[model samples]
Target: MPNSDYSARHLSVLEGLDAVRKRPGMYIGSTDSRGLMHCLWEIIDNSVDEALAGHGNQIDIVLHADTSVEVSDRARGIPVDIEPKTGLSGVEVVFTKLHAGGKFGSGSYAASGGLHGVGASVVNALSQRLDVQVDRDGKTYAMSFRRGEPGVFDDATGISPSNPFKPFEDASVLREVGKVAKGVSGTRVRYWSDPQIFIKDAVFASEELFSRARQTAFLVPGLAIGIEDRRGQEIAKHDFKYDGGIAEFVEYLAKDAALTATWKLSGSGDFNETVPVLDESGNMVSREVSRKCDVDIAVRWGTGYDTEVKSFVNIIATPKGGTHIAGFEQSVLKVLRSQVEANARKLKAGNDKVEKEDALAGLTAVVTVRLAEPQFEGQTKEILGTPAVKNIVANVVSKALLEKFNSPKRDDKSQAALLLEKVVAEMKSRISARTHKETQRRKNALESSSLPTKLVDCRTQETAGSELFIVEGDSALGTAKLARDSEFQALLPIRGKILNVQKASVSDMLSNTECASIIQVLGAGSGRSFDLDVARYGKVILMSDADVDGAHIRTLLLTLFFRYMRPLVEAGRVFAAVPPLHRVEVINAGSKANEVIYTYSQAELEELLSKLAKAGKKYKEPIQRYKGLGEMDADQLAETTMDRSRRTLRRVRVEDAAAAEAMFELLMGNDVAPRRDFIIDSADGFERERIDA
Candidate 1:
């Protein structure tokens, strides 16, 4: 073994680019999907940097054959001039060094994207090959690297057509450079991600790209962006340009809901401020500080359920928002409470009148701040940790909002005031409702906790991978209870009817004996008290009959699970047991007794009849479709849909959350007109066979 803590060993550090390839995660964040995309994003951000500098607007990203991407932007090419201090060119410094880029100094860019200078160099270090082309003055320069390739390509003729690299294998991807084109210049970067560095697939997702592209288009007004995929898939190609910028972006967000007021008074609830990072403990503390900073505020209050606040440190979304989010919340609370005391009514509800969740409810807000040198938590840059920015932002928002709410106007001030007042009233209602609901739930939870007397509860509690066979009626429940794996499976025999929590209030839902029993048995007491961790079985299987009533019961159960215990569905814990519609056995000329039995779907049964006609086996199979679960005995239920080894369970998955939400809202919400309209609209195109007969 080496000597403990040698001073000589501490002095030595890995030279050149070995450090990055060895630990790529440290620089690019991770070798996962996020980091793999970040490798490409670094190059794209450079182009975005140029666009920020007023160089060019057009940018083209091409996903190549080998899953590598080629990003070409028409922005001003990176400066190729030799630096006075370092003999190497600026491009070399940008590629090789850690924190070297134009964004460091004043002239490079003012409002640029990405996490500062570390982006490009980190990407280059990780990439197996990075090829850069710069058009400067009357000359065009090109350089290629195979992971810091030492030797240089001398007299690179990019202006000439003879070179092999000039005419790429894919001819359509490359466009010839126009020499005489004035006021148009930029650096085009083409690079392949090293599989050795990133473990995640380098393949890009159009969905992820679409989100970023949409956000960028909204930020930069009137900028058109064209996108295409690897197989030249040109679907979903729409420019998300907003003439009104962030204002229009807010409207787009609020497009799905009802807005009480029209005309965005400002950016919808986006309060941001650029504050100087305090480092008094460091040597830089003594430096003169008079950096006048600003927080761009855009606010809009809409009538909605969830409060959506998106914040950014610079152009990047701080998903795990830092002090900025905290500060914004603090300010809003302070200002709102003050106004409530001074100008608003006392209202009916006391403790429920004011709550944290209540205050932010229905407030769709966005807060983004830019700093000289932002302190990020990690390379993925999900959070902004700078202490000063939050305090500054909160203070600014608080003061501005206080003034705005306090000082009312003639025409539009009333609208703004009314919105604020609505925010307060909503908060009051929410608080009172929440408190009242919680008190009732607590009382109910205490009153009844164990599975109901009607349900045959299993013995054991450690029920992960266990099955909860929700059999219809007492007859099927009796069979399932006798056949169930008592150690892992539980039987819940639902009565003739159960309450639909969707159409019922919290009180009514709690009152429903069947639903409440289920809440207790699952160990996750429902409504506000439901915790996914407390689930009795990992697999909650609904074993209904193959009849119309069974399907209706299944839908009702699904609706209950979706509305009240959604985390179960989201976690992939909910499942529908697929019982055989037809049980046919060939016990005649060619087949043995039990060996020739098989199950079939309705379509499959029809196909079987057709096949029998074709084959000339005209004995008439006489298939029996099960009308109820009781038709099948304990043994049949055990072997087909209840047996852990042979059961076919369809795991419910929500492909489109928004669409599913809309459907659920239409079918279940209090609004009858929307529900009626939905039925009317869907009835024309509806497939009658899908629903219960």
Candidate 2:
């Protein structure tokens, strides 16, 4: 189990690009199609870096028939001058040496996708054949490499990677290929992936290339990217150019109806970091420097519940989501939650805190941060490791959103209000969904025993024939239990009025004892997840008193049902039990017993009295008025309100849901002006005798 004889003899030093060929996965990530694509990306990213530096606005990619990919860009070409350190041409040093390029503190590029300086050299080491041409200094210079060796291919037989190759004996030659017009400069690179290092089936993917090109074009506004595929039987070409930047990218990625316009947030911040610098003597040294980070974000909300966020650093996609994404999400949640909390009463959020998912629901955003030599976690560069960028991005986003929310412009104000309302709605929806799930699970785990304690359950097992009567108070519940048909009618009692759910959040409704008990008793879910088929009873009858206060309580119950369990009302299952307001006793002429008549309202009582008087009948002087359901005896309650054959039940119907919702909101919502105006407008048609004063 132990190798005690291990020594320096066991360690062998690899020179030039030999280390890369020995451990290709260490550089390219894998030996499959993904690794092959990574190598292609290394070359394409070099060209993209040039475009990002504002030197070029066009880039082209070609997929050759031989499976070799080529990338050309109208940017500053690779230097042709001799490198002082290596005593070789700049092209040879860049392609042969590891971690050698012009991007390391040369100030040649302000912000670029490549930072490690190993992209070109690593790609060269992994390619069976690589050819690079530079059009600069009014002349075209060409160089070729056969597996990281400076050489020339003898393509006399054919232009293939299997052609004879000769390495430079003493010195490498940089051949002058052709002449170009003055002041024109660019670079073109074509490379064949090494068969020995990659899988045989590894090939360039045209769709991925096109998508990358299009993304690059969008990231670099005004930059045109053209892709041509010669590998296919029919040559295909695609071109992408966008001037709207990430905003257009957001629009292209959005899949639902927009809830808000695309918003742009742009800003910059400065931070200090200590990094290695190349000294004059070619030694590595660490020095602290101040760097500016530019941030640009485009975001829009839609009607869907999905979230789409694409983040990048220096035009390179960070798909795994690093510090920058964290910061962006943090800022979004914080800002939106703050705004929602500030407008809680207006939106009726009612003590529920907004979560990150709520803030991100229906959101589509593109987050970009640009800085010099940002740290990446791996060679693939899918994640950013720089910690300072998080705070910087968060600061920028927070400032931008705060300004928008506080802006006095009407458009900004309207959007801000709507955004807050949407976030609150998402939060409520999430709560409702969670409660529904919990209710389902609880029903399965505890069965019928989990129902509320005060409920007087029906004896019948059939749901279709069972009715649930929501009585006003314990007094009414006692009489209802005695009067109701015990075989199929259940009783649940509530104290006074339940919360006005039209002005309450889902969490608040779920927390209210009466509301929660009612929902639990029904055995069906609520809100978007309400399942009418799972309901424990077919009819949900609200039984209160026969007076004004009872009417208010009934209205509250109706609001709860209409807002949460709306399907029950729409399916014609929700009803209000009408109790008699007056009981009139009439004396028969001689030996007949006195007859009792029940009148539901003053108008009905007057009509009954008029009819009785015209018929020359004598009755008791005093008429009994039912101030509450508790005042009725069991027989009277059963005959007047509980019996299915004799009772009058008003079925709640939503002929026009939109109008009903507006009416409910005007009466029970937190806003008071509309309700006040309604009362004032109806005052002209008031009748004093109709009031239950």
Candidate 3:
């Protein structure tokens, strides 16, 4: 029923760049903006590789209005001489032939970012038009290509991709455009992305371009990158040069207060790799070569608990990381754990072991490795697959960090001591939180309960629909008990303002009666050991009176939640109950019952009064102003603040934790100088009538 015979006639082979054009994803990774950017990166990385080899120090890039990108560098230009085998110029071979370049163990480069020799060729094939000019040997040579084919463009008016073009039928030409001064050598490349290959909406991202340029400058210290943009009405330009390398990079990435100075670690190791070599007879042979891997790192610890670690391979960014990052983290944890254990008595760490998270917390680091022809996981090069690199990098990091820890310098000794104490403190906090969680979990059994007697808990055991209302005082708690639905609403009453946990130590916070009771009633651990899945309630609502003292009490409670139970806030499960501040009773005509209206804000009350006057409706002269929840009856409180369908609730959210932390520190922290300054600065915006004297 079908033709089963398969023969040689059916076999087809794609030659030159045809295979690349057919399966572009295999080379560039996609046909979207990302792939377009990858092509640009390929060309830029080649120039950067030259700089990495100490051949250049300046590179310039331009983004033209015509959607074309140009890169120029002051480096040894691509050779313009003829090749014996192909009879083509080195520039032509580099751009037209796949898997052909000087980077494949030609002794031209000791280490480079380019591997497989396909970067330049793939970019050339994907570009609609490419122009190359090289200054070498006191002469300037030029070449043009249309989609990987060497040709000439008849651009008598202007340089454009749509200009008339002619491809060489028999032989290609590398024209000697002009002559240059002696000792001048460089290369300039400009290309237009092919619309036929990429999506119509795809365009270059300026931010990504600038970020990559800045990163490269950091990786290769002393290399300057100048960028100019003519895509907008106003021209923009930037120059990036870093002398401190990754140390400056680490400083730029850190956002919180500093706990330690930036430290640098540098070392190298050697490993043997089996690779193919070109024999003298022009044949390929397998041979083993000893390769050296150099690892350089910069690291610092901050006062906040956020980790930022960037890894690179031969100046190329490996954002997803690989063996190098694995090795770095492993070594850091090992060294810190050992240090913490050795000095347990001085730090008061009582048999509590350190964890990987503890070692990484508050750390900002940059890890980079340089090796020749390292194995990459894919064409995108997001990961490294060299197994030996893991151990090599691990050994380097371990030895260098140990040396720093044990350095004889006074500054080094002090910093090491502080860092160890911080890690031990974190370990102890984790252990304490875990102990609280286990103790509370055991008390959750119905037969034997240790929950606070004052907490009026809901009857339901399910957590999804359960709610916890933290009331202001005993008076409000009595009314809430009668207004709440006993099946799902739980109440926990506090006598007055709780301790500000932001300024208090962990032990002080855990030992306070009110703080301990709140933590115990929630049935979840505090801080790093908190398990969100085991939380007793679905929502936490703070209900307090509408006054200055009420606001202060709420702030103190929020400080506790933010410091110890941050996950609940991040998940948007925290809320503030909104209670009406005024009640207006409108007198109806002819014995009809009066209509009562409630307002939450002064503006809303004024608007309602204006509308009622315009309608010629009469209301009671003195409206009732609620000073506290105690003044409201049970039914009124239920309708205004407890009934889910009728009450107004404001959800509390933390969009920027750093900004929130700063504000909390300014207001509640022990440093009174900054708080006094803030209050003095804000005095102009304060009002007189808002305060209840």
Please state every model's RMSD to the true fold in angstroms: 8.5, 17.5, 5.4
Give per-model TM-scores.
Answer: 0.69, 0.65, 0.85
lDDT of 2 at 316: 87
lDDT of each: 0.63, 0.85, 0.86
Q: Give the TM-score comparing model 1 with the true structure, all chains together.
A: 0.69
lDDT of 2 by residue, 1-693 (tens): 012322222112125567888888888889898888888888888888888777788889889999888899899898999998777788887887777776779657777775378888888878889999999999999999877777789989877888987766667789998999998999999998888889898878777787887888889999998888898789999999999999999998875457788999999999999999989887999999899999999999875555889999988899998999999999999999888888899999999999988899879999999988989998778899999999999999999999999999998888888788878987887777566556543233236465788989887877888899999999988888889999999999999989988766666787899998888788677765577888888899999887778989999999989878889999999999999999999999879899999998899999999999999997898889888999999999999999989999999999997678678878887768988999999999998777762
Cα-based lDDT at residue 347, candidate 1: 34
Ranking by TM-score: 3, 1, 2
Of candidate 3, the 10-residue stretch with the lowest lDDT total is 1-10
Which segments of candidate 3 are over 4 A away from where they belong?
1-14, 114-116, 137-140, 176-184, 232-238, 437-455, 470-479, 492-530, 542-570, 623-634, 651-693
Q: Residue-pair clashes per candidate, as listed?
A: 19, 0, 0
Q: What is the TM-score (0 to 1) of candidate 2?
A: 0.65
Between prediction 1 and prediction 2, the one with superior TM-score is: 1
Question: Which wins on TM-score, candidate 1 or candidate 3?
Answer: 3
Which pairs, if any, clash in model 3? Answer: none
What tens-digit string does per-residue lDDT give for candidate 3 at 1-693? 011221222112115676788789998899998998889888888899899988889999999999999999989999999988878899988898887776787656677785357988888888889999999999999999877777899999899998997776657789999999998999999999989899999898898999999999999999999999999999999999999899999988775556789999889999999999889888999999999999999999866555889999989899999999999999999999999889888988877789997888779999999988888999888998888899998998899889989999999999999788778766776776777677665233455677899999888878898899999999999999999999899999998999887666556687898898888878788866678877888999999998889889988998888877889999998899988889899999998999989888777888999999999999997998999988898988999999989998888899999788778878987768999999999989998656741
